[model samples]
Target: MESGKLLKAIIESAIDGIITIDNRGRVESLNPAALKLFGYKLEEVIGRNISVLMPEPDKSSHDGYLHRYQSTGEKRIIGKGREVRGLRKDGSTFPFRLAVSEVQYDDRVIYTGFIHDLSKEKEAEQRLKEYAAELEELVNERTKSLKKMLHALSEAKEEVSLSLLKEKELNQMKSRFVSMASHEFRTPLSSIQLSSVLIEKYAEPFDNPHIKKHVSKIKNAVGNLTTILNDFLSLERLEAGKVEPAFTPFDIVKLSEEVTEEMQMIAKEDQNIIYQHTGIESMVNLDQNLLRNCMINLISNATKYSGEHTFIEFNTEVTDTQCIVTIRDNGIGIPESDQKNLFQAFFRAHNTGNIPGTGLGLNIVQRYAGLMGGELHFESKINEGAIFTLSFKR
Candidate 1:
């Protein structure tokens, strides 16, 4: 009797809903959990068809399913758990998991069903899906923002690189300017000072030959100063876009002769300038002053770089469509490595280490030639000789 009471107490207090049905499918007993799940009182549901707690089509077809099982002794949902819908007394439907089992009595069989509500589990699963979608959208937005930041950083880096490059170029130009001002200006200034002192010392004794020699030295120093000043001024004007070439008809051969004669005064001792004219005509249309400056630069370089007594050739040829001048010198020729930068300002050759120059002559000459619609090219072999050719369209 005590064991029976204990079993009754366990079933009454169980959390899952439990119900018993007879062989005829009539409700034999209902637990407190089952009454609460179906919203029915013990007396109201007892002896009624157990299908009363089911939602349609199960409500209509469950009796048929039971009768088939009883006749054939075949098992369908017996001893297995399945998801099913239940009807409440308020005519509402709820989802639940149902497990059924059978017990054999002395003369009949009885069936018992266990029920568990699945409303909370379904609701929790739906909440998880919503959270996953929201997280994916947040991640996409963050990725887009990161890409934009990277693009902005790339642009900033490019701007910084350009700024540094411009600064480097400016520094290089300033250094070259300082070097030019120091070397070019000091040489002529020292020469003029020494010659003036010597001229003063010899003036008291009145030596003609000595006075004349010192005067010539002073004149040459002054001329050197003038040439340096002109170079600087021309560079400034070119950079400022203030120089324009004026072309006119002129005798190119006669101009070359005059320039050569002037350069001979400053030529090395015993050096001779060999002038040759091969063209049919000596006249051409060009910028006279600019042409003169270009020739002066070339002839001066030939004289300066050649040894004493070396013969320098100045040849001019005029054609129907062009005028060409060639200046060939037997001097220390340019090294192959230095030829590429020969026309760059402030660039001196490696072989001409002791040669006194500002390194601006060829650069200025090339620019002037370009302005006159002319071309200047050269060929040289180290320790042998060099030839410079200038051509202009008529």
Candidate 2:
């Protein structure tokens, strides 16, 4: 191929745009890439000044810039590349990199320019900047939301603490009132009980059945009141931390027999308390008063709940390692639903219909057993039977 033809072919196929201008800044030649970059035909741009392809002040001032550089030999955009705008044939503008070179052939001087389109690169950079801004905004929003949630949780925790303190104060006030009322009522109730018994003895001369019956009713009523007051007193004392175990070596068998005898007198017609002892050792170190109270409470419950002719089994076994006492009854047993709350203060079984009770006996007994380093446990099913066991470690 000829050198000139080869040069022309290279200019036509070049990816970057190429343009040539004379010393007067008139367009001398434009490669195919340059023509496409300016959206102009080759023939149309041949004789025009290269400034026609520029926008705004650059279009008007480009001729003076070239003139000044030629005269003063000062370099601005002549040798080094610079970012500039190009105006298309449709009057739209775009960014490009423009590099100019001065060429001298004999006496003629020309400027050659190379252009690189910068549209895609600038668009991508803009998009990345937008994405970075959006990411920063999302992070800030999440952090603010988390801080609000933490503040709300802190307020809720403080409210819960205050409510708990108020509840504790109310419970203390209730305990004080219960203790005072129970203590004051016991004296008058005891007096009523003694007067009723003495009246029954002194009025025997009248021998009237009606007088005897009414006197007996007064005595029974007073007895029930006294029992209720005693339960209140015991509970108050326990809550006040005044009740402590006094351990001593004593005969558990004898204690069980005595409780059984006392409870039998109050049992229903034909009802009996059957007492039995196992294990050779009856002498165990325990809080005798607390143990006796537990026995009396269990036997009393059995006497009240069991029908006529039913027998309450009060069995005890003292071993070298432990002492076990179990009171079992075949009576209206505790309901499955009520059993969970059985040891709670003032809780009563639903099956106890019309029975006179303060509902504190079992709770008191359980507490007494705990003071004496013993455990109280029970098993029951509705209308089947119930067994209460007390165990003490030696």
Identify the candidate with maximal TM-score: 2
Mark the regions of model 2 whose C-alpha exceeds 4 Å error after superposition: 1-166
Clashes of each: 0, 0
Worst 10 residues of 1 by lDDT: 131-140
Q: What value does the lDDT take at residue 77 in candidate 1?
A: 74
TM-scores, all candidates, are 0.50, 0.56
* TM-score of model 2 (CA atoms): 0.56
The count of residue-pair clashes in candidate 2 stands at: 0
How well is each residue in 23-109 modelled by candidate 1, as lDDT tens digits?
888999989998998899999999999888888999999989898878898754743478899999989988888888888876889
Per-residue lDDT tens digits of candidate 2, residues 1-394? 6998999999889999999999888898988888888889989989898889999899999988998979998654653489889999999998988888888866988888889988876675555445434433443453354345435433544454468775566456546545654655566556656665665675565465755666666566666766766787787789879998999999998888888888888788899889999998899999899899899988888878888989899999988899999999999999998998999876799878888886899999999999888899999887777999999999
Q: Which pairs of residues collide in candidate 2?
A: none
